[model samples]
Target chain A: MPVSNSLRSLLPVLILLVLFALVPLLSPSNRFLSLAISAGINVIALYGLSVLFGQTGILSMGHAALVGIGAYTAAIVARDFNVGFWLSIPLAGIMAAIVAALIGVPSLRVSGHHFVIMTFAFGQLLSIILTNGGDYTGAASGLDVQQPVALFGLSMDVLTHYYLMVVSFVALSAIASWAIINSRYGRTLRAIRENEKLAASLGINVGRHKIGAFVVSGIFAGVSGVLLAYFLRHISPSQFASFPSIYLALMVMIGGARLLLGPLAGGILVAFLPELLNLDPVQSRILYGVCLIAVILLLPNGLIAGIVAGWYRFFDRRPVQPNEPAVEREGK
Target chain B: MDVLLQQILNGLSIASVITLIAVGVTLIFGLTGIINFAHGEFLMVGSIVTWLAVSNGVSFWLAIILAMIVVAVMGFALERGLFRFTLERPTNGFIVSLGLIIVLQHIVILFWNANQKSIPRPLNTVWEIGGVRIASVRVMVIFITAAVVAMTFVAITRSRYGRALRASVEDRDTAALMGIPVRRYITGVFVLGSALAGLGGGLLIALFPITPFTGGTMVMKGFAVALIGGLGNLTGAVVAGLILGIVEGLSAGYGFSGWTDAYSFGLMILVLLFRPNGLFGGTSGPKMA
Candidate 1:
């Protein structure tokens, strides 16, 4: 890469990395660390979702199931078989990815409301299975997990785990998002989203692309789930319910799904919005519902897209070429 | 055999309540091309209103009718105020309806204090035939629900209003070109659907307690049944409703009592996987159009 191109490419991520490294050192409080950890987890999960939602244009209402799969897989493996945390975490993501692929075969056939309902039921079924599997799965109370594995000779502690989570959070989101958005696969997925029939006519395998998106989404959700389980030390069916999935989708929408900064903004908002408002549990939900409405009405293309469009119009100092009228350019 | 009969009766009672909700959902989808996520909230409003009215010295029958009328008015107001402007954007209407669900839910909580309220059943009569005992309230619900279903079926199929509704569903622009009052028909359908939902809610009050959050599960069931029997197919919705009711009843009966609640949702997922168009959903081509 050219020197200027490399610097331009690395600048934003370097800034983000510096910010992540400084967060814990500046705050150092347990509560802040906890909140930061939770937000990190959400960012990771939302990363996978942005790929499927922003790239493939598939709206899944049951993504928490994939997260649950990751959490439970990690929990069960680490607890029952006493596997290392590193080994168990990846296993959780793989398990979720496999299940997502299986479901995607049929789900990719349906679109719009049909796909939404399909994913919704899939999430419900995952919860039911966890709740019904009495002794082995611990039924409704959810299973518990063991502590983190030491990295070689180094002992793992909570603060260390928190930083590790932050690193993974930044790395997974930035790398995965950059890779997908720039790849040929991502282009094909975008084509499918724009117009599936047209994409098929152009020799794109729409179904395979959709399944790949679902699997990739599930993989991210799973890894996030494992991190969540490790951070909390417990996993419950309630944690993976439909409400969280809806909240995740809303977060992506509010932050701007197609933008890298969108999930980060959303994760922060979803985490702190309730606390900032000091809302009671039920009232918090009402506020969330209202927020969803406000976002949809005001930000049709999402907050990031809105801001970008506004920024480009204001600061970009290109002369108004009469032949290249703004309206005609925008029409494309 | 008696246990089976009792279970069947129980299933029928459940189906009676679900049929009302499902049919309303189907009607709204058919006529307006809008999915009212808040349809369950209307049921919630119906039940809460009936409970409040009856507790405040109104006759049960009067309270039930009053609830239906009130919900119908709310439906009309909704169409006139919000839905009419959103006809060009169905997706906007859907998301807005979800917002309405939260707003309505909070309003209920604010008024009713989040407590579960039970309506008193006036009927103490019971029938024991061939060693099977049937609660009079269940029998009453079944008869009333059956009558409503029959009347609704006839009204939609034979009446001039029904023909207009059918015309609107077939092609909204063509119906307008044919000089049919499309807006009036849409509003009427919304009102009628809400009335049925309210009526169902009132009847359901005899069997179960009502809470502010009760409509969420019921709405999921309505969606499931509507999908299974096929959207825009009234007869299919009715059959699907009964099938769902029976599935839940059997799940509750066969020692997996808690699993009963998950049965419909599970069935919905399974059906979507195998038959995305639903069991009787005809013509996959026009699903979106």
Candidate 2:
């Protein structure tokens, strides 16, 4: 008999774990290690976006604001209340989740277009408030974050912080995303995405489910924000504008919205490419725009989904017969 | 009293510009069923081209017309090349427009060098009435907008092409079956919308300076107008634009100036809350998500 199906499916997870374990063993230079760490941070947020767009089909373009909220929360809490990273971390996620639910409640109740506009407004409103928030938010100049979050009474360096983030939050976030996508709630969400009316007819509260997805996505973004804040050591309103939201949306699309590993690939592409290629900011942005158009027109399901589907189509075709039974013909 | 009157005038002038831009968006949405984010860039194109023409010594009237023609042609080419492919899919159209936003802005910046450009106003004389001062340029803007709105009203109500556009917007397949060239009319709407946006941009030169990056803010305002008036509802768009202007004016005038953008956004949120179909109820339009 074949091995257990659960174990078989976990093979991919095992492989990824092994790869991550081997990451540090490669003895990468100071720079490569730093790049890898930032890529990891981006991946967490990318996965959050995947939950919203990929699983829920919400197409929100404001995850960046949630990320910013998370970052700001962490920075402010640390600066004012003298909280450690550990406490600030959970607080950030909670704060972002509340804001997401607040905005998502009414907007998500409306039609999809309104939802898009509302999410955009959420980002814009956040930036505006931050700008006028005066000394508390440091206004337009933004607040510089000090005090590295210490663990076990010891302050960590950049290199050690990278490992801790990767080994702890990054791994946990991935596992949590995997669990959410495979759970009963996840099944209902997927159903709603496929056909909202049908799902509602079947007794699924579509609105509630959509809100749940938004909150979960917001939590992911918040955690990612915390990571981003730690990485940058600063927090500001300009950092959270709709452009970053669009960038997150772009990253999700580039990776293929529906694939588990898609955002992982996408985050890496977005984070590392500009730095490695030394591309002009304007040129890189133009490249993103062109790629988005090309991807939608030529590969609407995203790059990975397109490739996998194409591969399956190539080798899985069945010959048609004029005399085939109706059932068989239908399957063909 | 003078301040209040002047603010009201400012609000009306702004409302007219917003209505001009919002109309273009609503027209495209009505016919093509896509929210064209690049509509603002059309305004940008119009302004820049007009500025270039004027600075190079072209007559102001000739420059504005040339600006309209160039932007309209660019709109037609974009529709045929890029937008036409995404017509049946609103979601794709949305994403494609975002892409076009990036591409168009950069292309403008690359050629124009990302500098703010302003034209010397030919009509700078200020008119005073009851302690309120109104720039002659403001008067010109209001007059031109009135004439254009009237012309547009006539075109949509009386002309054959306008009838075809309205018919297709009401029901596409039926219009096609009824011998209307639905495809051509859709493209025509795209061109017309672009031309209107271009002309609005040219008109804005008398009021304010512009840069290649200004399109982002304009598009946001256009979206606010479109949402407030119901998406795809032209009449609603016009009313919403004026309402936005008045709200912004009152808020900015009354010392809530720092929160001007906030007030506009808050109004949009309120509209989305109370009149999800827009202030003047219209079709919900297609939901993409």
Candidate 3:
């Protein structure tokens, strides 16, 4: 407990400083830069889902809808109005957050399997609307986003996008992970996850907390989507299909849903595994299924959780000192 | 009047297929609380197997029987290899099933290609009555579905195996305490459920082209039907399937063919919002146990 307390006390500041120093140097090559960029986007998106799933215990099969909303918002603003990238990015994220809140209103009424169905339906409906929205959404052909413009005299390029994504992903994941574990709000959310009625009896407004988490999750997903749109310079309904939501869920599970960096670890593993294998789309999906099953069966606590716990045990081998009450309390 | 009769007949044929699929899904979910998304892939496999068997000169009925047996084996293997491992963690079980769906669909694509494949029509007659036109094949489908449903009803309500399965559904631990072999019953349900799915696939081949991607639509519709009737409710699945078939038929007839897919999902969302327990399925309340 004392060892863990000391590590926890220093982790945040260490992580932030390390990330800030390492991000700019991450562009080893164009391919590496792109993978890093995409991984960052995935981390941002899964951050939202993790809060809902890990914290609030609501499984949303439609988190991609928020991503799609953000992507489309950026696409529409950039392509249609020829707006600046800086202006459109925030606008898109804002629009996605708002849409997520609206859908969350109805979704907050249900939880567990019922919530899963609602989110799945919402995602499907969004896809249908986007596909059939005709001229506005470019119909089934999808929308084409222009390359982002120069900001602060720095040209928009692969390296720039990669660094930007890394900054956003690390910044958001850190805040969200810290906020959930350290804040009273996080305590209430976790309590609701453990037992809704019990949490309610403890004077927590379960419904409001659920909606709040949903909204916050949506904001993270929106930011991810906006970055993704810029990275690809094109957005399509097909890219944000139901399957992506499933993949996100798989990533969360594989990374160990209970941990903050779980999504990042899971996302990178899943995303890179397929590319590394040079698998076709169908084969990739099949591998994902197989991988998911293996992970669930062998490592239910997820890859990161198992590793982190193992690392903690291996390093902190010393027995507790009797005079370490303050350290013990912090650890607990 | 003629159009109405034809539409009604069409509705019945579709409803029968849905009943086969939904009841299978409902039975498994009812007994085990495992939402097997891969259930539709069983149907897909069965159809392709029957197609292969029939093309090789096997009799239609014989091909169907063999396909059902094969799917039953696959179901058993899946249960032992995957589902059994995740019984204590149902959410993980769901993800596992979903993964299976992807794997199975890809396997289909590998063998059958992505193009649509059609089974040779074994029955080519059209039967007309009361100004209604029904394909002889479709009538056969309706008859087969009715017979299966009737047989299942008797088995569930009257047979010893049915009693044990029901007891297991009510309470697995208590059923075990009461001398029921819960594992055996679950294995039996998985086999039976897979067979029902195989039968549905065989029947569906007569009405629609089989494509590698066909399982997703069927799975979604089946889930919607199960949700509509309430989770694990057999009779609820029947009524709900029929209602869904009719709604789909009418939607397609009224020139909203594109929205036909949306209709079931829309209905499911409404149900989740208004009656999470389902219409006749009776209290699908989350099992905290």
Candidate 4:
């Protein structure tokens, strides 16, 4: 934990952020920049997911509902209370966290299979409720956010400005996620994930810690949701349905949920892979399904984890334990 | 009173179909420890096949049989090719099933457009009893489901294979050590479960219009029934399914149609909170790890 060691550990993240910062300077087309901005927002949420799935070993199949809650909170607050974008960001996150805690409390009591099913049901329930919300929820056709995000006398209506804002948030999220993963609480979650009974025997409050992980992830999803609302200027219940949750889960799984760079890599790859391949939405989804199966079977940790292990094997000539902490593996 | 009776009858028919799907889900989970998210997709495929067969001039009953066979074969293939590899980790099996949901749904969409498809009702007759009218097709579905459930119950309780399946469900390792072919039993249960879902699908299209996306909603309801009945408990599924169908029927009939789905989800959450092991608490499922 020396200053030099801390800086060394942050080197990769710093390099990655610099590259992200240069995207707009590269003079990419607006369409490409928009896609990058969307991906950046997803990366923010994925970092939260990594802490839950990667560190705590709990996969929430209803994460998109949490995101939807955030998005809807922002829209409602802006419409009803005349809140601005800046205030709505924190408001949305808090709203999502509160809902996450409510669902997580009872859901955490069940076993893994039941938990997954419960979350899936909850996602469906949220969408259905939204669709039946009548005037309050705009009833299914969805709500439009009329207010544009303004910062320090500068309008973020331009694509470049919005992209930078999203990128900065993504960077902040990555740093927060990195800090969490390296903290004592992260290690406790990891210990619980490895062996809940053993961790409980050692005086760890397993249930509280698990719920805490869910809330943390929920906050990330909420912030991502606000960014999405402002970026698209519209939000719908369908966008945050069970399939989107599955989509988010798929990206995290494919990118190596345990790795620090996994979310950024996963977000960009999933967003652009179909475009790059010139495939239709259905075709891309089929490909994703195949990729997920292959990853789970052959590379249980994910794409980046597999590559990192291979790199270590090839260069360092040392056998990396499959369960070795990802940060330590990278630091070495 | 007549409307109440009619709703109750309608509820029974709905419950029958739900029971078929829920029992299949429970059976597979009991033996394999894998919650097949694609089980509803199997049902969808079955309904599609039934529609194809009936449109191509096959008898409705014969078409149902054909669909069951086709889906059973698919179940066997998946068990051998995909699920067999994930036995060591049930969570992996679950993920693979999620993958299967995407693959199967899109494949269906590619072959047949995403529009809703319906089959002609073979029995258009309506029987009126005590001022309550019931469609003959509904009665047929109820009778067929009841017969299937009875047969399944007898098989599990009286037949040699039933005893073996029960033993395996109770303790897979011990069952395997006792000269039981646990692997083959797993395949058998999976295939049987898939076939049951196919039968339910065939019956479902007779009652309602279906699309490629119907699996998502169907699976949710099926899980609700299965879990509420106590996962891995067949009797629990039937009773739970009956209760769910009746409640849904009354709710929709009484002008709460917009929130019919929400009721099921809310009921499921409440059950999970109160009885995490399910209402019947007769799970042969694995211990929480």
- Give the TM-score of chain A, superposed on the true chain A, for all candidates in the order listed: 0.88, 0.88, 0.84, 0.93
Q: For candidate 3, what is the DockQ?
A: 0.47
Enumerate the candidates' DockQ scores in order: 0.41, 0.44, 0.47, 0.44
lDDT for A100 in candidate 2 is 83
- List model 2 lDDT by residue over A1-332, tens digit each: 12354344335654675587577777777777777777787778878877877777777767789998999998889889988677887899999888888877885556555667677777888999999999998888888777676677666555855655565666677677777777788788878777788999999988888888888988988888887787778778988986788778777887776666677777777777877778777777777788877877777767766666667669985322111110001000
Off by over 4 Å in 2: A1-35, A314-332, B286-289
Candidate 3 vs 4: which has more DockQ: 3
Indicate the worst ten consecutive residues by lDDT in candidate 2 chain A: A323-332
Scanning candidate 1 chain B in windows of ten residues, the lowest lDDT window is B280-289
The docking category that best describes candidate 1 is: acceptable
- lDDT per residue for candidate 4 within A1-332, as digits (tens), equals 45566455456866887787888878999989988898988888999889988998887888999999999999999999999899999999999999888778864577665677678778889999999998899988999998988899899988999998998898899889878887899889999888788999999999999889989999999999999998999999999987788788888888888878788888888899988999988888888888877777777787887887889878986743454432111000
- Sorted by DockQ (best first), the order is 3, 2, 4, 1
List residue ranges in candidate 1 displaced over 4 A. Answer: A1-14, A149-164, A312-332, B77-103, B110-115, B273-277, B281-289
lDDT of 3 by residue, A54-75 (tens): 7777777788888999889888
Which is the winner by lDDT between candidate 2 and candidate 3? 2
Which of candidates 2 and 4 reaches a greater DockQ?
Answer: 2
lDDT of 1 by residue, B61-152 (tens): 99889999999999999878767655554555565576677778887897678988888895878899998888999989989988998898
Ranking by TM-score: 4, 2, 1, 3
- Give candidate 4 regions above 4 Å deviation: A1-9, A319-332, B287-289
Best by TM-score: 4
Q: Provide the overall lDDT of each model, using Cα atoms, as 2-decimal numbers.
A: 0.77, 0.77, 0.77, 0.85
